[model samples]
Target: MNIAKNMEAIFVAAIVIASATSFATAAVRAPEVITVKAEATEMPTVTITAKRLTAEEKAAL
Candidate 1:
């Protein structure tokens, strides 16, 4: 029974240590920055011409 209790304590200590180590390493590590360069291009221009239909043209249709 004492040995079993000692093993349980060891297991819990191991888990706590592992969690603390992970947190410490994460806090100590620095983040990486990635940069991308893209070329800018001009878009093509579009022109549209529209005429309103007269009353006579509507009647013809």
Candidate 2:
């Protein structure tokens, strides 16, 4: 009788452990990756020159 009771206790403990592990394995989350995105606050722009640099200064650069 004592052996039967001990076996029943172990069986219940194993079933509880297995159920907890199955729940834990099934509740897995996907790996998260960090993504960096810049918000475009404004569009591209262009500017025209009214006065140009000297030829020697441009060539020296």
Candidate 3:
């Protein structure tokens, strides 16, 4: 019974140590950053349209 308890304690300790090491390494590591570049092109043309309102249309408003 004592031997069984000792083995169980060692197993639990091993698991705790493994978990702590994994967490420590993760905390010490830095995140990677990636950058992207894009080239600009000439601006596209824009068109505007206008129409004269009829006297009757203006009167309706």
Candidate 4:
């Protein structure tokens, strides 16, 4: 009975140690960095023109 209890304690201790170690390792390591480059391009220009309405057109509306 004593040996069984000691073995159980050891098993629990091992699991605790493994969990702590994994957490520490994960916290201590830095994450990977990635960089992306986009190509530059010129856009086309647009022109707009407006015309004034005559008195008859305004009356139709």
lDDT of every model, 2 decimals: 0.88, 0.90, 0.87, 0.87
lDDT of 4 at 32: 88
Error of 4 at 56 (Å): 99
lDDT of 2 at 22: 93
Q: Pick the candidate with the highest lDDT.
A: 2
Error of 2 at 61 (Å): 82
Which residue ranges in model 4 land beyond 4 Å of their true spot?
30-61
Tens-digit per-residue lDDT, 1-61, candidate 4: 6877699899999999999999889868587899987675966789778898999999999
User: Whole-model lDDT, candidate 4?
Assistant: 0.87
Which 10-residue window of candidate 4 scores lowest in summed lDDT?
Answer: 36-45
Residue pairs in collision within model 1? none
Residue range 11-59, candidate 2, lDDT tens digits: 9999999999999989798789999998999988998878888999899
- lDDT over C-alpha atoms for residue 30 of model 4: 83
Task: Please list all clashing residue pairs in model 2, or write none if there are none.
Answer: none
- How many backbone overlaps does candidate 4 show? 0
Model 2 worst lDDT window (10 residues): 1-10
Q: Which ten residues in a row have the lowest lDDT in candidate 3?
A: 36-45
Candidate 2: Cα lDDT at 26: 91
